[model samples]
Target chain A: MGNLLRFEWRKLWQQKSLYICFGIGLAINFLALLSAKNFGALDSALGNMCVALNSGYTSFLGIYIALYACQDSSQQTIKNIYARGYSRSLVYWVKYAVSLGVTLATALLYWGFNFLLTCCFGGEVGSFITAVGQALALQLWVIIGYHGLFFGVAMLLNKLGGSIAINLIGVDCVFVVLSLIISLLKIDFNVMYYNLPNLLTDIVEASLMMPEFTSSMVLRGIIIPVLYVVTFVGAGWLVNRRRDV
Target chain B: MNENRQTNYVITTDNLTKVYGKKTVLDHVSMHVAQGDIYGFIGKNGAGKTTLMKLLLGMSQPTEGKIELFGSHQLNLGRAKIGALIEAPAFYQNCTAYENLQRFAILANAKGQDLHALLDFVGLGNVGKKKAGQFSLGMKQRLGIAIAMLGNPELLVLDEPINGLDPEGIKEIRDLLLRLNREQGVTILVSSHLLDELAKITTRYGIINNGRLVEETTATELMQNCQHKLQVLTDQPKQAEKIIKKMYPQVPLLVSESGVEVIAEDIDSGAINRALVLDGVNVRGLTAITDNMEDYFIQRMGGNNG
Candidate 1:
């Protein structure tokens, strides 16, 4: 298992797509920072940038994670690993762990850059740091949950194009349609409030407005994403353990 | 258990079957590949050659049956001693050959292997830096073989290793396989559609038709079963046939397009040539013919189909 993890790490670093995705993220950050003055205040600029990084990074993260997850199957190289007698469960988990690690790492880098850029553009460093610190836990969970969902789709589909399409478009469409149905039915219970996207928005909003997180906010944030992570990773592992490569 | 201990077979399968939906891809294939033997697995396309290899390598599970490698049923542990190249040689196309091999070597924990030496052994020493996607089919196949040679595996399961090679490339791979088997005593189970190429190195053969092991025979037995005949190309075919028939009345003789064919083992060609010349029959040519592996395979498949 250690060897498999090492192998996955090496493979992840070797992928050019990882760097391309990072480059796109960096470019978007620079663009967003360049337009920071239009928001009218340094605090508002930092807050908006925090929200965008927390929520919008998922698009790039989803695409990048999908590519990483589906690479072995797309290139037909998974057989090499399996032929070495490694169990499918081991391979799947190692891949998930490595992808999750990279996703979190990229998220940190993006947040760090956003912090530096906002401060350089005259935003208060203390406020920027405080805002990031408050939202950090929920931010990490949202990234993990979304990564789990994207990785699951990639594993089940095992096609580059389909995985990317589903991870980016199909998932958002499902959530949108679900939200629409709930709204039309006038349901008192808003399930979307606990979903990863809405939770992300709520976390950003609450972090900007409130001084500290209430226990209820923290509990809901942790519980929902953890559930998403467990459900998706478990389902992906089950299918991968049985499906023929 | 004692029987298994005494037997030197490297691979043994019992009633191995693979079913996809309503179709049975492999139907109760029980095969044995002995140690120190270059076992040739011959079959046409979609005949379950790759599927069987997949099962042995643990890439796929069998619907029914058992597979024992080196006399043990713990396949996952046993498969650690095996290296395989099934279907197409898969690799990270963007990575160079050396990088690709290095990653797999790391995964296999083959710390002591000299990647440079392995590349040289596969005739890709200088091209190690070249990306695998830029490589030709033959080069990719060689790289695949090099990767399989990592960890110095005890057994090799290769599916059509020489599929897209030129004649020279094919001969090089053949020599390499022979050297690996002869020098290092690596047992190989290689499947190929090229029967003639397989015939040159194979000590044992398992002919599979429609996912069934129709026959298993050693080289000597296969040679003996293949037809060996003496032919006399003559100006007077009828006269030569008559003369030969009268000389050896019990032998089977046929007048073919080229000459009079005497289908028999150990024919005294000198005596027949002298007798035909002495009888004033001009013997244009005298030659012997033996059936090749292709002919034998075709005949066996045809017979099985019938």
Candidate 2:
């Protein structure tokens, strides 16, 4: 298991897609910061940071996760791992762990850059730091949830273009169509609020406003996405175990 | 059950079967590959060669029966002592050949292995920093072999390792496999459509056709089975048979539907023809018949015309 993890880690870092995804996310954030009229305003810059960290960074991470997850299948290299005598369950879990680590690390890096940019160009660093600090945990879960979703799709599809497209577009479309159905039915319950994207948006909004989250809201924020992670990754693992490489 | 046989065989399978939907890809394949033997797995396309290899490596589960690796039913533990390259060589396309080897070596926990030396062993020593995606099919094969050589595996299972190589490349891979088997004592289970290439290196053979093990024999036994023979055709069949058998009393003779056959090495067909003709047995024709590995394979696959 240790060797497998190291093997996966080495392969992950070797991927140019990882760097490209990170670069694109950082470039977009930098451009958005530079173009803002109130660049020096602390509240505006941090607000922008919240949005970038939650939605923009998560999207990039999704793309990277999709690419990384399906790479072995696309290149037909997963057999090498299996041929080395590691069980499918072990391979699946190791990949899940590695992707989770990348999710956290990329989130931190995005947060760090947002912090540094806010410090360099915006107003009062103290409030900016506080807001980021408050939203960090929730943002991590949100991205982890997205990683799980994308990784599952990648594993199931095992195609480069298909996995990426589904992760970036297919998922959002389902949520959109679900939301539309709920709206047309005039349902009082807002299920979309529990979705990862909406949860991320809510976290960012609440953080910037410094609003107190109700206990139920906090639970839903953490537990819902955690459930998504468990459900999707578990299904992916089960399918991978039985399927031929 | 003998201790010597148990210790000597590197791989054994009993009634191994693989079924996909309504199709049975492998049906009751029982094979044995002994230690220190280059076992050639011969089959045409879709004959379940790769399927069986996958099952042996635990890449796929057997639908029925069992596989023992290195004389143990605990496949995963036993597989640690084996290395395999099934079908086309698969690698991280974006990674360099060295990087690919490093990743697989890391997985195999093959520390202290000289990756550069392994690369050199496979004749890819100088291909530095070039990603595997840029490599030709033959280069990828060499890299695959280098990767499989990690941990100094006791057994190497390669499926069509020389599929994409030129004649020179084929010879190089053949020599490398021979060296690995002879010097390192690595047991090899290699499958290829190139019978001539396999014939040069294989000490034992398992010929599979339509998901069935048609035959398993040693090199010497297969050579004897495909030995040269003299086929004599004459108008006087019984008289010709008598004259030939009496004349060459030491040579083994068989009368077939076509003619009388002298089944022996270095049979003098001209003298036999002269003897037959001088005895007033009108000779229709005399022909020397030989069966190579290809003919034997085709015959085993139920394509024999004679």
Can you give the lDDT of residue B195 in candidate 1? 87
What is candidate 2's CAPRI-style docking category based on DockQ? medium
Q: What is the lDDT of residue B129 in candidate 1?
A: 68
Model 1 C-alpha lDDT per residue in residues A183-226, reported as the tens digit of each score: 89998877776667778888888888887778888888788888
Error of 2 at A67 (Å): 1.3
- Chain B TM-score, model 2, reads 0.87
lDDT of 2 by residue, A119-180 (tens): 67753455445555557666777777888888887887778898888887786788889889
How does chain A of candidate 2 score by TM-score against the true chain A? 0.90
Error of 2 at B275 (Å): 6.3
Q: Assign candidate 1 its CAPRI class.
A: medium
Q: For residues B1-306, what per-residue lDDT tens digits would candidate 2 score against the true structure? A: 485375578889999999999999999999999999999999878889999999998889989988988888888888888888998899888788988888889988889999999999888999989989999988998888888889999999999999889899899999999999999899999999899999999999999888999999999999888978888886677888899878788888888666788888777788888888788988788888887889889888767432
Who wins the TM-score comparison? 2
Task: List ranges where model 1 is wrong by over 4 Å.
Answer: A37-39, A44-52, A127-134, A182-189, B1-3, B230-288, B303-306
Task: Please compute DockQ, using alpha carbons, for every candidate against the native two-chain complex.
Answer: 0.66, 0.73
Give the Å shift of residue B92 in candidate 2. 2.1
**Which residue pairs overlap in candidate 2's backbone?**
none
